[model samples]
Target chain A: MENNKIKIEFLSYSENEYIARGFVSVFASTFNPSVSWLSDVKTAVSEGVTNCIVHAYPNEIGKIILELEVNNNYLHINIYDFGVGIDNVNKAIEPFYTSKPNEERSGMGFTIMQSFMDDVKIESALNKGTSIFMCKKLLNSVEE
Target chain B: MDIKYTVSNNNLTVFVYGELDECSASQAKNILDRIINDNLNSQKVIFNLSGISFMDSTGIGLLIGRYKKLIKHNVPSYIAGATPATEKVIKLCGLYNIMPKY
Candidate 1:
């Protein structure tokens, strides 16, 4: 397999979360992954993008960049947001930890991403922005 | 997202269709709440997620929020017809602790 990459930039709106999921799922389809694997990828992408729309730009809309790369059997996803960065990355990732509990946020976005992806990383600077990098290993790739 | 409900024998069942994500959750919350409130006399409530094609933590939040609302009225809630994928998320988030799957 050869390396492939795609990049998308869009507003950090709740609706774009679905687009992000669709884009990554379609990209991962090139590997002929199983239905379960594709669903996992889509769910992970949804969480990453929702994080940006809900938490990143809580006050106003901002830009979000989604980058997808396929290398061998691995699917790499990078979701970047230029909004109010997280004040505590560690606390933010904790299970059931939410900055906006009143909004009915489950605070499981990062947990879902980490659960579905093989690797997860977060980089953020207060008043700057936050970027989430996630990678998933495609197992049992159906042969053509 | 589209939400339809049926009331029978003092029970309220909400059927949700479409992706349950951040974008749809707020809408779902409002619709579900209204239905549940209108059917407050019901003894129980159920969420039919068979029509849902995708769900994430936001979906979990939506369900949990509704569960909290129902519990306040002494109306218990159960989840029904969730796909395996959605169930995985529900279980991972411990939503079953509050609303059991039927």
Candidate 2:
């Protein structure tokens, strides 16, 4: 059972609270991260998910898939969106960088994700899509 | 997020509450800008973070931007009421060196 992984996908709509509920419910039990750590992770997750809704499709609709896997005391979360892909991931991570500055975005979404998570991996291609793969290690959990 | 503005003895204070992340940062920045512009001659501007429950990197950005604006006019900036977790993030970001957290 340790080898098996669980994945949850939700539609990228403003009304969908399932993404947050699903993520917190699963990670709360699996990692038992500190409250501060949990809040950081949750905020980062919410920011990424919100970006998918605001940036990915523009006027069109899309889906966001959150895949979680536990491996060797580390939890991996992959948030994937098949919408308009990022042209430059580096620029996106830079502080005060925002493509939608007109919308009053602080442009620190990627930076917060990088700052809070242990590891952050982003993969994207123009018009293809963007995927963020993040990992956090459980201080108390041991390898299976 | 909840934002409150108050004036105490010639000083303008802004209290930031709740989570201030990428989404709500602009509001904070804009409000601060307005206060600073309105009180350009005021010497002290205090940001009370007592009510803030969660804050991320965006919070740091918001604070830094305000610091830059206030510094241009020789106004002193102060921070107070940061929780341990919030304080940790502020320290880790080296903002304490720039804007001392009281």
Candidate 3:
């Protein structure tokens, strides 16, 4: 509900690239983070968004909602989807584990999120849905 | 990310271009795994990373995995063309101590 919070929803399709690029850039610039940090954030968001497209819906159709909130010290990115939830959250974070090996997935989505973000948390059940909450802190700037 | 592999004589050359973040790390691993399994008898494996701009901890994992596989086959591993960013990560992970970097 704050002025710094941003919310957008889009279909979980390959064309989400444009949507992702726009949202990530706005959030990165708003926080005055370095370009390198922005790139990492963008890459992590891409991985999470792509996972929603490829894993969440499967053969069905669905939508993904991205919520971003930025304050002076931290930036939060939340991705949500209403699809078949992950059955094994632990195994899913393994470096080389992939449920869709036939699709050539490397199963590194969650790993990327963990490595790039300051904090990552996943909540879901078998048939409910999945939500990924990530937060990154800005270290350089302070309130004037 | 674009991945290309070339085998000549007894060396396996892997050229990884673009970014090798967590998203593309597994794809790189799978491609390398396939190449190594089918050609386990090679004398050496060379990773050409001149075109790589950015790499994270996952990149380190991939390199170490391949290095181990090559070692088991008695094949030495070599790397070249690492950008500053890539070099910093490699050093942070202490990979240069494990294998030769060019």
Candidate 4:
């Protein structure tokens, strides 16, 4: 499955959160991910896509890009947007450190991504945008 | 998200089916709040999350919001049938401290 890769680009809307989760779930299903693992990836993908709809493009809408790659025993995910980039990446990842506390944001977006994925990396530039890279290992895929 | 609740013997049981994330958080909170309020006499509230296929931070926010309201009305709440991944998120957020899982 080293050559299987899918990329999706969509508008930044809360409605697309479900689409992202559904699409990723279907894409990862080829690897025979477990129920818990599938759910974890869906949840993480939802948060990443939602962050773009909420924080990245608060004033205006923008394009959100999602890339999925399955190689060896891992599924790699990359979500990035072209909107307002996070100013402080470190503080943003801290639990309960929501920039929009008034919005009922539990500030667990990054935390969830970190907890669910085997590895997570975030990169952002001021006024540019944010990109999240995550990977999950498929534990039960039988060899071809 | 779809929310269905049952009231019996002064207990309110809510069954949520669908994804609970930023997309559905507000809607879930509103629907659940109304149901819980309509059953003000409920002494205990139990939330069934097994039907939920996915959840994110907003899930925790929704649960915490409901727990706070339940507290104001003197109702003890419990979480039941959370999926393995969903339960991991809940436990990581320390929700088990407030609402025990059954």
By DockQ, the best candidate is 1
lDDT of 4 at A65: 98
Per-residue alpha-carbon lDDT of model 4 for A1-144, expressed as tens digits? 565999999999788888888899899877778787788888889889988999999999899999999887788999999899999999999987889876767788898899888999999997899999999887675334
Ten consecutive residues with minimal summed lDDT in candidate 2 chain B? B19-28
Candidate 3: where is the Cα deviation over 4 Å? A1-3, A14-22, A94-97, A100-107, A141-144, B1-12, B19-42, B53-102
Residue pairs with colliding backbones in model 2 are none
> What are the Cα lDDT values of the candidates?
0.89, 0.75, 0.75, 0.88
- Chain B TM-score of all predictions, in order? 0.97, 0.92, 0.91, 0.97
lDDT of 3 by residue, A82-126 (tens): 988889888877765778765444466687778778999998887
Candidate 4, position A57, lDDT: 96
In candidate 3, what fraction of native interface contacts survive? Answer: 0.00
Give the better candidate number (2 or 4) by lDDT: 4
Tell me each candidate's TM-score: 0.96, 0.74, 0.65, 0.92
TM-score of chain A of each: 0.94, 0.88, 0.90, 0.95
TM-score winner = 1
Q: What are the iRMS values of all candidates?
A: 0.7, 4.3, 6.1, 1.3
Clashes of each: 0, 0, 0, 0
Better of 1 and 2 by TM-score: 1
Off by over 4 Å in 1: A141-144
In model 1, what is the error at residue B21, expressed in angstroms?
Answer: 0.8
lDDT of 1: 0.89
Compute DockQ for each candidate against the true complex.
0.88, 0.22, 0.12, 0.73
Q: Model 4 misses residue A126 by how many Å?
A: 2.1
* Candidate number achieving the greatest lDDT relative to the actual structure: 1
